[model samples]
Every structure is written in C-alpha cells, then in structure tokens.
Target: MSEWVDVHFQALETCGKRARTAANMLTVEDVFQDSSAKQPADAAQASMFGDLSHSGALAGKVNDVWTALKEELGTGRSRLQGVEKAIDQVETNLRKATRAATV
Candidate 1:
C-alpha cells in the first residue's frame, strides 16, 4: 500500500509536469504556423487540379480543421492544471487514509 501510494504520486507528478511543459510548448502561434504552412502543388498536379492560384475550397477546409484543432490544443493548458489539482486531492486522501490506518 505504501509502495502503491509512492508509485501513484510519482506517476501523477511526472504526468503533471509533462502536461504543463507540453501545454506551454503548444502555443497558438505554433498552431497557426502549422495551419498556414503550404507547399506549392507540383506542375502536373496543379494542371490536373485546376485553379492553382487561390486558397480554394480545400484550403478553407484545411483552415477549418486547423481552427478546431487549435481550439482543442488550447484546452490542454487548463486540462494540465486540472490534473495537478486532482493529484493534490489524491495525495490528501492518501494521507488521510495513512493516518486512519495508523490509528
């Protein structure tokens, strides 16, 4: 049981720290850059596809997908904070259980 508690605490701490780091790293600008990245279609493909100049329907769809993805990534920061809070609660509960066991 003591070992179990130690393991859970360690896992949660690692998870929380990693989550926080990931949340910080995944910023809106990064997402936007990722979304906006473009490669010119090859000559044959461009001729086959037609109208290679404008951002067309497919580009708009890609933007929409990226917009949704970016919003989801934005939530990760709060989710990490929530995980840390839950870990604190679990630690408190474990301490209580330990005290009760000693009694």
Candidate 2:
C-alpha cells in the first residue's frame, strides 16, 4: 500500500460520499412532499418510494464502509513505508558487507 494506493482509495471514498449525498437529497426531497391521502399509497408508488429510502440507507452504509477502509488504507500505507525503509537498510548493510569482504 503505497501513497498512490492510499490516494486512489481516498478518491473512492470521495465518490461514495457524493453518492450518499445525492441519494439522501432525493429521498429527503420526496419526504418533503406530501404523500397524498391514499391508503398504503398505491403498491407501485409505495415501492418506488421505498426504493428511494432503501437507496438512501444503502448509500449511507457504503459511505461508512469507505470511511473504515480509508483508515485501514492509512495503516497499510504506513506499514508498507516501514517495510520499504527496512529493505533499504538491509540493502545498505549488504553493500557494506560486500565492500568489506572485497577489501
């Protein structure tokens, strides 16, 4: 997990946020409109409304997943950096060993 990977993951998170916002806005806007006096609000109408509500909730959940994944990605990036540093150190040590052996 390099910085590039972390950045890409963050971009995905941003997309998730935008999607969530859009979903919520659609549902909230519909909520603001009166549901009419019809009982159960017609099966088709109810289903459509329900779908919007469900989508809004799903969007929220997706956002949550992205948030958690972002944190994990940060941890992964740090871990990878540490590994790279360690590898560099080992390479330096190996080079020094080779020079000493040559001498």
Candidate 3:
C-alpha cells in the first residue's frame, strides 16, 4: 500500500510570493544606479587596467555583466510566475476533485 503524501499549497504560495517580491526589489536601475559599489567598481577597473583604451573595455564589460544579470532576473521572474500559475491550477483541480468525491 502506498502512503498518502500531504502537499502544503499555502507554503508553496508563500514561497512564490517571496521570490517575486525579491526579484521585483532588485531592478536594473536599483542595481546599477542606486548601488554604492559603482564608484568602487570603476576605480578598481581604472587602477587595474591603467590605460584609457583598457578602461573603456573594462567599463563595457561591466555594463554587459550588469545587463546580463538584469535579463537573467527577468527570466527568473517570468518562470516563477509560470510556476505560480501552475500551482493555482493544481490547487483548483484538487479542490474540484475533493468536492466531487464528497458529493
């Protein structure tokens, strides 16, 4: 005989909400503009490279990395939203099943 497994849909919902909240809080502007580390990053690049051409390259690379991070976060948020939708569908189906069974 197979044992019954309990699924905590509420906990899953809470997790989804927390993840979305975190993702929303870390917007591209917040990461780039509002960050305290921007000046330090520029200084470090300039100190290490020590030339105008290399400085430009390092700056471009840094910008590219930030852009990539932003894109990745957006993708993650979209995927989490999809998961939330799936969870809602599953909960709805389970409720319908329980109701039909009781009837």
Q: Find the candidate with the highest TM-score and give its number.
A: 3
lDDT (tens digit, per residue) of candidate 1 on 1-103: 5788778878867876776677676666654465666533422232343676753655666667666766887788778767777877777787788789978
lDDT of 1 at 73: 73
Cα lDDT tens digits for candidate 2, 13-99: 565555444444443234346765332222222334465757656656666765565566556555555555565565556557656
lDDT of 1: 0.67
Model 3 per-residue lDDT tens digits across residues 30-94:
55675665523332355566656678678668778866886887887677677767767776676
TM values, all candidates = 0.51, 0.40, 0.60
Model 3 is weakest, by summed lDDT over 10 consecutive residues, at 1-10
Q: Residue 61, candidate 3: how far off, in angstroms?
A: 1.0
Return the TM-score for candidate 1, rounded to 2 decimals.
0.51
Better of 2 and 3 by TM-score: 3
What TM-score would candidate 2 get against the native? 0.40
Ranking, lDDT, top scorer first: 1, 3, 2
